[model samples]
Target chain A: MQISQQQRQLIQLFRHPDEVEFSNIDWEALILTGRQNGFLARLYYQLERHQRLEDLPQYAFKHLHSAKVFADAQRQQAIFEANEINNSLSAIEISPVFLKGTAYTLLDHPVAYGRIFNDIDVLVPKPLIEKTEKQMLLYTWFPEPIDEYDQHYYRQWVHEIPPLKHASRRTIADVHHNILPPISGRAPNIDLFTQYKIKTEYQCYVLSPAALTLHSLVHLFFEEDFSKGFRDLSDLHILFSTHYQDEKYWQQLRFLAYETGFTLELFLACHYCEAILQTAIPFTFKHELVAFSPSPMQLKCLNWIFLRVLQPSHPNYESTSYRLARLLAMLRGHIKKMPIRILLYHTGHKLIKAFERGILGRYSDTSSNLQPQPPDKNN
Target chain B: MQLHQLKFDDYIHKMTNDGLCLDLGVGVFRFKSHITSVQQNVYEMYADYNITEDKPADFHACVKLAKGPRHYINPQVHFESDVVTPFLPLPKSQAFPLLEWGMNWCLSAYDFNHFILHAGVIANQQNEAFVFPAPPGSGKSTLTAFLAYSGWRLLSDELAIVTPDSLTISPFVRPVCLKNNSIKLVKDWFPQVKFTDTATDTTKGDVAHFKPPANSVKQINTPAQIKAIIFPRYMPNVPVTVFKLDIIEASEAIASNSFNHNVLGEEGFKTLVKLVENVPCVELQYSDVNEVATFLQNEEW
Candidate 1:
């Protein structure tokens, strides 16, 4: 509940806007140490206003450094677009997903639009995946060794094949055969997905609204990847909030999941959207259509919290709540999957380690920076 | 307003109530009076003296700190000697925001063991943090401003701090740097967003850094694990496409854009690699923002 000193200072600055001064001393302490974007922005504005920045010869020199970054973005974008087009053409059935510049910008607003990309993404037909692989080689897009296992796994068991990379662009894109995994232990019929495709200026493939939401939820949870969840969450928030007005949308969503053999994804999607996005699904639809048990939002919130506790800094209030839900869900997962004996053993081990790292005040040589040596690694 | 003594030539001063600390230059000095300390140095700067004057007329009236040579300055002016850095002119905006946003990848890059990532971040009202990490042409700043202005909470528009845990993303709340056409892109998108004057042709090509929204300005230090690390490259006449990157490969890409990977050593590398491993990485190629938003709505992060 308490605000950090930095946050408190922000409040003071906002209240007494004019008196706030950005001096060189402030620059070294606050700006150099700062790790966030907001502080950088505020500083930029303050310097420009005072006119003190422009007068300094050194400041003008620094401007060149930032300018180069801008130029690189422009060049990188050109390279990315070329690769995406090439990748799409080579794939048997190329369908674009939530590529922010290509799709997110088209759907979302301008604020989420910053940053340059170095790659492209597209979905290809499952059956022609092997052939698509052949075409990719022609375009110089190859697979990394790490994806060797993923490719095999996806080809045999999952909805999307292992991601492919372009040798030239150094960018990789995933090729999806279906929106979600075939939970029934069989490849979910491809026709079911292709049948729901909506064509745009980009291409002729997209998951249905119901399917997209279910797939998004499954991706968020079952996939357990949060890299782009912020953007994805924003998207889901908008999609569900905007589409929920249609009374029949929920029924259709349930029907798609059931028919596509990803009923679990549907259940989870509803669980997360409501828990994090505060998305509302109709009660009648929940009762009559989605008979499959939906995970409780309260429990999900707890699961999220446990995961969030690992953050170096406490998450914002909403993030904290969601983390709690996610934490609870994680526990539920462990309980459902692991035997009681194994769970107890794992819990005991974790507790012992936590005690050592926390209460004992012992800094073990193993984890401590006892030895200073050069690190051997590269990009 | 209390001054304390310290060991070694290096003097120390800090705010008792806050996280502000300063390292003044080395010197052997005695307190001249209760409220003021006098020393003869490179010109004579007084420690604590309250004088009512703007740019003092007489330079010798101030207590002189004798280090090497006599440097002349107004006696009434209270120089910030607490911090080791030399006196600098006042910044245009608030101190915290200006320094937080403006001092990245500049002359003196601090060793934080994490890259000063150039990206924009935003969270929804729900506080789900999404990061768009890209170079200038990637349309990152433009997209960030658009998203923040639209509905999502603006976490940052420049630096995306990736901790050793790699899962945590700290907020920077820096201004969104809009270049050339993007200045119009954002202004046209959200007429309400405030912007600093567009400085012409300094480096980032007809650049203007958009002021952080009032709400976003307050939460600059709040950190979140990157929900998404998007690499956006804009291309005219190209259809929108998003590609998912494998974690290992994504790690390489992320590393390339890192500002402090070299300084962070193994822990930094491991953290970043693990981050890309756990999070989904994608390349977005697009020309329009609306479709991009629609596509974003369709995918699961």
Candidate 2:
């Protein structure tokens, strides 16, 4: 697809952050709407990465946008500190996965130091979630009770509970019990996080640099949960290029994968990061991993996998399509483990709904007006 | 109650006998003196007039009023320490009684960051809360009104606070606002139901308020755990049939209906999933209040 005018200007700004020469389009308008929104970042970094970052406009160098960057970084520091305080009091022992900005802060990057973080992501053991919640309560972080049944459900089932938000602090802490589904589902061996765990400087976080990379890829491909856009991709590029610099790191990563039961996931991440970011994964390592990941359907499956993960904002799409796509992606993720019959039942139901919405337009938002008013109900 | 006594900073006012306490943010308005006048407007609109006292206005924009020991109280408006106060003139005595029911007028003045959802909730005799989650036209308020009148305890006829782990409902049991024709349908079914006045040309068609069922008065402070989640899609002529929804589907629905899910992240996702697994979820299709009530009562909850 041809890039929109704003997209083209965004591409220019991102590639040449040092050059601020726009003819008619205001520089503030260019960066504020296009770049700040993460749209342009998504297009260039996630969708198209062959584009060079050196070509983007340079607003920071002019000292005008420098304050914005500084403020963002300071905001990140505040979040990190607040999260650290929560961690000190939390009951569950959580390992921080140094995601984008947090990771950048950890690695001492020369770029903007204090970026604003929306949340603090931490991985926790599944069994310890209840205890963690009790710990959260000690700090006055409580979930609003929607219903008793909902409370029972979250406490008993599910991967993680809704984030415990500090109402006054406005800090959101995501507590994950499992990295992957414990049931027959895609992304197995989530607990393997224990193997490659390492502590960070600020807190006692178990981080596997390689697992972190794979997790980022899982988030990118399967989760398509791309709210950060260019910034996240940039982090991926930096981490990949900087961490996996030696043959020792590559062999260690491969060994780490074999132990963790994520040989395919690690290999795919390495291959794609290199292909997309022009990241310098060693040729010998790339060739061997490619031989192991020989499936044409990997990319096709990856598309829906990521699409489901990213779950776009296309309100025009049918709810059934959204649900079916999610189910299919999930089933495929756990193909070998989960029962085919159960998957079939779930997938069939979703597919039928998708078909109904697609062909008959039975559930169009456009007909939301056709919704029966109170006593007018005549379904 | 007058408007001046409601101010949080001015607590030196004389208390009045037979006055209702008003808690509006930081300002307290002891408003029993004006209750009769306020009730005049409220009765014209078919809504009850009452006083809320000693309520901590957790939100910054609230205005409280109540009757003090010896004198009438005024409207009290509180502002957060750091933020500049917005201009909110206390409505005159005639406008006083209609404030709470008419607070929707102040909706535009608030920030647009949050999406406003219109729905209601009620708890069974067991105190298990059932969230009737729906968009504006789903007849949630109408159904909530019927249920409240049918002896079920009304929890809230508005916002259902869906938190990270549980769906907590506020015990704001005032009156259920029945819009447009639902008012007539309700009146025809329950001829004994006391309605305020039917105000016309309002947003939700012709609107009126139903006296909260007596049980609601007692349960106004009780918060119920969400036991059943019912998505009501009222088809004007359709027979009442409830379709049981599966956990996965219900989880998705709860997530979408949630006030602040995305901000909650993995915890939110897990909460919704957990809720679906435990709650008996269903999609109810009905036209008549009688069938809807019967179906709800008969469900194997």
Candidate 3:
């Protein structure tokens, strides 16, 4: 990815916290970019570790401090909710596997430090998906209402059911039956990931190091939206820098990637993590990674889109090319995700919904700026 | 110089493009609005706040007239504060009030370092502050407005900012939002006071804003030592009876009304317990604003 000037400074700051020349930095742009991209708190922790938190301009200092406070609270809530989910599922003898942001947090991995946790994702054995969801519903979890089509769509064709939100706590939990949507035709066999589960001290199940790395790599690569792409890529960078030094871990990641039919995700992860973040790779693995690179033309198209879409989506640094790139990414993802007929039905349904909302909105007397209506009538 | 000192033309010119930045005592915010009502109201209400191009703007607040091309069909304005917007778009008429509410959200949501209470605060000349922590329809703003005009320095009419682990409070004096029947009552009481044209049928019912006095803005950086927690109940035609609240009751009241006490968690509980014990807590019930003012003034410090 071609990082923006603001993004480069953020990466540079993350790499070397002690070298910040505050006067040269645009405090506003950096904070805005960091906030939009969800890493302000991580940078705060980095500065504190290097004894440079105190050196920040008061403006930057407070913004980072505020982020740290917020992240710390979320971490506590994440732990609490994870415990609750674990205890609830334990009743049915089902061990749900936590994934992504929540899993990294439960493992106490450095990558989880200062990460924002909005929801908890858990993978259940396909046989126990219904049983697990039932247990969750018994204890404060209810479906965030969706239309009949969406409900059918998730149960029939997708990896996960509709997300369950806690009644009082408002925490969302996604129950996945497989890593990828089963309809995608590219989903790996569930056994490839399920066999490598590691239970944390919290009695929660998580993927092993190599397995978790592959899961994250595949998740990022298969996504349609890249609003949080830069942050996800950074996650891969940290995952590699921490684990790739061991030849065994690197070999295991490649083996699983190939076995799971996600060699492309593995190749892209390594390429961007090293190329973008300068995540160091051992001298031995460098030449072998080059062998997995896509053809020059394909790589060119991928790079052009990824580079534009990965930067912070803030107005200050957002380029004119981002919107077009995002549209291309979304289109590429849809084509990759569903078969032809289902894709047409889904796309057509969404267009009709948008048009219906607009027509209904037009009937309301909203032309007059002075008259008051319900706050959300227009949106 | 305070914002009023800027030439009217330059002020509008600045707000239309680069935004007008001002210090609101607790933090500085850069406010931008293209809506005519928002500009007109802000020009009248926020005249006393200091204008600056400070290195770090604590919040970037704006009321934009555009939602998209379809915005021309509906003509709505949305309040955006920094990166997060907790509010939905309102009719363009509500833009000024929407921005004011947005500013409050920014302070309480982003600035978690301080304990922000959902209350009003006004202090005596000795800088001994009286905090009025109450719910909506409690006549809190009307009381705060009456006293702020009657020589008491206004610290804040909403979101009372307290320094953690201390009784010290900072001034966040902006325009006091007076809602519904209280708007007419306040206008009648202070005939000369300038107020925004009341926006009707808002979520809070008809509402108008009262500009705070210039003297309060002068002490924007000054801190106050909180001496009392007063919970006012506007009972009609009643005597100004001051009832004492025990420490536990006071602490519970303060805790429930606090915006960030839960966010701060354990430290917030400890600081609040200490504050309730330290301050004299009382409930003042009265119908007449003048009587309530006299009762407060004559209280033992």
Q: Which number leads on DockQ? A: 3
Which lDDT tens digits does candidate 2 get at residues B173-236? 6556777878898998789877666656543456667766655755555677777889998897
DockQ of each: 0.02, 0.01, 0.38
Report the number of the highest-lDDT candidate: 3
True contacts kept of each: 0.00, 0.00, 0.18
Residue A117 alpha-carbon offset, candidate 1, angstroms: 8.7
TM-score of 2: 0.42
DockQ score for candidate 1: 0.02
Interface RMSD of each: 18.2, 20.8, 7.1
Q: What fraction of native interface contacts is shared by candidate 3?
A: 0.18
Among all windows of ten consecutive residues in candidate 3 chain A, which has the lowest summed lDDT? A370-379
Which sequence of candidate numbers ranks them by lDDT, best first? 3, 2, 1
Considering the two chains of model 2, state its CAPRI-style docking category: incorrect
Give the alpha-carbon lDDT of every model.
Answer: 0.48, 0.51, 0.82
Better of 2 and 3 by DockQ: 3
What DockQ does candidate 2 score?
A: 0.01
Error of 3 at B61 (Å): 1.1
Task: State residue A178's C-alpha deviation in candidate 2, in Å.
Answer: 2.0
Candidate 1, residues A325-359: lDDT per residue as tens digits? 54554665455434567558657865776566444
